[model samples]
Target chain A: MGRRILFITTDQQRFDALGCNGGTVARTPVIDSLARDGINYTRAHPQNVVCMPSRSTMVTGQHVATHGVWMNGVALPEDAPSIALTLRQAGYRTALVGKAHFEPLLDPFLRFAENRMGRDGTHSEMFTMPDGSVVPHRGFDHMEFAGHGAAGNLHYVGWLRSEHPEVMGKFVPNLDGDLEVTTEPGGDTMAPQVRTTNDVPRGWYHTEWVADRTIAWLDSMGQDDDWFCWMSFPDPHHPWDPPQSELHRVDWRDLDLPAGYIADHEEREKVLASKPAHWMGWYDGSFVSNYEAPLKWVPATLQPDQVREINAMVHVKNELIDEAVGRVLASLRARGWDDDVDIVFTTDHGEMQGDFGLLFKGPYHVDSLMRLPLIWRPAKSAGIAPATVTAPVGHVSLAATFASIAGLPRPDYTEAPALPVNDDDARERGFERVLTEWDSVLFGKEVGVRTIFRDNWTCSAMLPGTLHDGTEGELYDHANDPLQRVNRWDDPSVRSLRDDMLADMWDHLPSVVSPRRTCDAPV
Target chain B: MAYIRRDIHIARTPAEVWGFLGEPARLHEWFPISGCRVEGTKRWIDLPTGITFEEDIHLVDNHQRRFVYSIVNNMLIKDHFGILDVVDDGHGHSIVTYSTQCTPNVLALVTAGAAGQGLAKAKRILEGGN
Candidate 1:
């Protein structure tokens, strides 16, 4: 057995959210330090933007097709091999400490854990109550996690009432339906009893429990070991709110709302403008007009004040996670394994924290969710790559990279390893041409493709006008507009460029996999 | 000692599904466990008042979904399964189902409701074709 491996992933962590990448410093020293010593791939993107699918991509280097974890209620492809199997085969102890949303396909390798039920989520929290009632929040061996689909705002349950009386009536699951989230009474809630405000001194939040458990595991390891461990965070995902203390830090007066604050009268004619407004009661997220909506979590533009509060909340969250990262690293060093172990740090996806005047993350592939960060600390012998990979890449590389490090062989079923991870000059291998694609959404999700360039020439193709809802064809020349504020789809000069991108997207389809063969694009 | 057993070829392998089920955070992704929240060390207070409950995963039979854990918080139900039995049936697939009787919580009336929901989610998760 070689040195132990520590893999930690943050929930909804954006690529630009890190200090090394000019992500707001609010406070990410530990993560930044990890980047300083490791080879940071500036252009790593997720194979699947959502939790379940993205996690599948992380375990299997191949896209959704090969690994078979395409939808929420789907199982992993029977033939597909996961990273854990390979590691165990190689004689290393493999343990996943937190958030492993490889659902529908139930994480089969969980048997390796001496312990189970680390993180908490909606489905995991569902349980059979004492009185023999169907209670939400099932999976965790411990109790903590609530909600269904996107309805459980982590606050109050729709049907299940909390034992603590003081928090009663503080949360209403049925209150928010603007976006069709599944609300249930049987779930975990964060109301007056457990306010999500960034206020509590740092260690009291739920994230603290996660980190404490995972770090303790690392602390318990001995030098005679080679192990693979994963720690996943659930925050910065939803229920965005100003930490009571951090609230108003960025007042509406100080913030610049996205172009799509709320749909204009005319825009309302196209999509249901009030849909997002109604959902505000259930979630805490904000996005801009140009913000892309995801099929899973629908995005909504927020009130100017709501936007400021959400932004402050986002910052405070980063601070919290940053501290958690610092603590983990301190403990790693204390164990005398810091310099020896390989550390992988990154997130599931990015949160649209009011950037596009929208709150929370949607199913669409906006730069917010699709373009997440991938930071890796190379082994002592392997050199680190410094510049950002301007090329396009997919999230599938997580498994490929880890497998390569452990010298594990690739499984026979995955879509294909999209990119190769390198200790040195790896950024050069980032992406020749990256393509972004979406699976079947609720009835109708824009099933299109996006191609990004090192030079920032971006093209997206879906249903016509998807640029707003699920439209078709968006072209952006980022050199002139770094924020991608303008879409030049109609630009005459880019006629040939548009054709080229379309061809690239169509060609890349074969490489990405989709679980729902029914919704899969015809070859 | 009665158990209902069947085998199906889930799109992903046992290892993959195990990865999904291994973490408590992933329950909401499938099986409709509904809402959840973790408190204290291992005590999980489910909502809608089924009575407080606590459970712990004591060991794993790696070859099988056969995990041994005790349901204690509620005390009313002594539902426990030691072997998950996640093995290939040799018919181009594998079988993973537990055969444990629910001890029933305070609401003995709804015990079956909870059990049915859990098993249904497991079936959908294990057999869903992504």
Candidate 2:
């Protein structure tokens, strides 16, 4: 019998947030246990730093260039080939439960048109064809959506209204609201930390709802049935709200400054000046500001204490995620299917998490933002030893890996290499370098950035005139400065290394002859 | 949320118009899906994108020349009900009025676009435009 696959993904979780990955703040024992029992890839990177592109890559096994979801606001083509479709064709039951940010929440198609017609409602559900057979979204036979906000999330909100009406009215809008305000140590102005403690009971939390539905689905499946489930969690991403019960599970007073945060502005300015114009704009509040803006630039006036408080909330969010994961695992064990299932735990992209004085992510593809924590636990019968793989891998390899685990022929359209799951010495034989791309129009300027990570050296370059009048780049020796504090692109010592990496990145550039236009269909 | 209703007069008979509009299986020819299946009063449609929608057919009256259906258990829409009425204009022509009500009423455009395209195609095929 094919092993049941339980794939879990978290949004905006950093690589170092797990205890198993040497994180000091977050308490992620359930996730840490997965690393202890499974194979952990320490240096896995996302093909793109943003949500939509990275998720599209994960499902389609195609790079952002091929999938055409290079940035937000673009939807993945309905007919695009997906891993879920491949697995279903091979007779495996597939389902996706949780956040699927495949399309922008505020798509123009969903907007009201002058003709009094528009596609209302979020397009996260399965599209019905004329025939009797239901087309699985991307290829999942069943989908349960629980998006970011209550207003946009139809399924979760419906449940909340029926099950916890009072809490829904009181807490849904304020999920991201600041519950506490305090004056910075010396500053006269109060810097409000965006954090909330949910009054809704633990059982009604979205995380628990996801676990409950997923477990109910698993229970309905026969013991002999083969299945592939993508249980995505929307938390630890933003709106930094954890249930009051889970928030108390972790003491915020125990948290400290993130590893790479440079509290000194003078030192930060020196580091920022050495990089591209967009990077400087992010620190100085010129490129983008405010959370609602499409371009996600950090505020320059953000205090260090505020950063610490946000990180503390992030840790609490991680704790809640861990508990949810634990409940799902326990359900699997109760059904006596734990031994027959293979689990993959990872995140879409990393959060800045106070790295280099930045809180969130944008054009910057620093290690803290690009690197991901990927752990794979095979079925007990596979007998794969728990070991750390230091080789470079990216989200592009997921579809191919899922196909391999299902014992099915890999689809012909996938561009990613099949992950080395069975090979015990895979780390020693992994890719020498991995590539990630970014293409978006930010601040009325089109920006394209690409980074090539080779061992301990990271190099990033921006397209000419995208950010400023001239082309710009950044190089960092992670071996000495893992926090990416200094840019050494012009340093004589690493010029040759930088040149080689840049050449490789240029070769990997996707050739664009004609970009695919958005679908103009009325629906 | 928005609302839209369109009435079109076609140079065809009501029976000829209902022949295409009443049959769920012919949805793909004019609508977006590839094919549709109807069991009792419930119809399920298959779109080109591989997703499916379950719609309940409320009224399929040949005498009244009206067809009513509502989408149920759909992710993108709620409380969606659609009505298609075909009336003999007493001059050997048929007038079809398509109306829809749904939450986030902006969906009126989707219904309008589909109705506009479907009715145009039905008129053409009935009047030998295809």
- Of the candidates shown, which would achieve the greatest lDDT relative to the real structure? 2
Candidate 2 deviant stretches above 4 angstroms: A107-134, A169-193, A289-298, A422-430, A516-523, B1-130
Q: Which candidate leads in DockQ?
A: 2
Segments of candidate 1 deviating more than 4 angstroms: A73-79, A104-201, A241-301, A381-388, A409-430, A443-455, A463-471, A511-523, B1-130
Expressed as tens digits, the lDDT of each residue in A405-428 for candidate 2 is 888777887777766653355555
TM-score of 2: 0.74
Give a tens-digit lDDT track for model 2, residues B49-124: 3557789998888889888898889876766888889888999789988887765443454455556656777777
Looking at candidate 2 chain A, the ten consecutive residues that score lowest on lDDT are A178-187
> Against the unseen true structure, what C-alpha lDDT does each candidate score?
0.49, 0.71
| Candidate 1 lDDT over residue span A199-253, tens digit each | 4333434455457767766665666676777766665655453234544343434
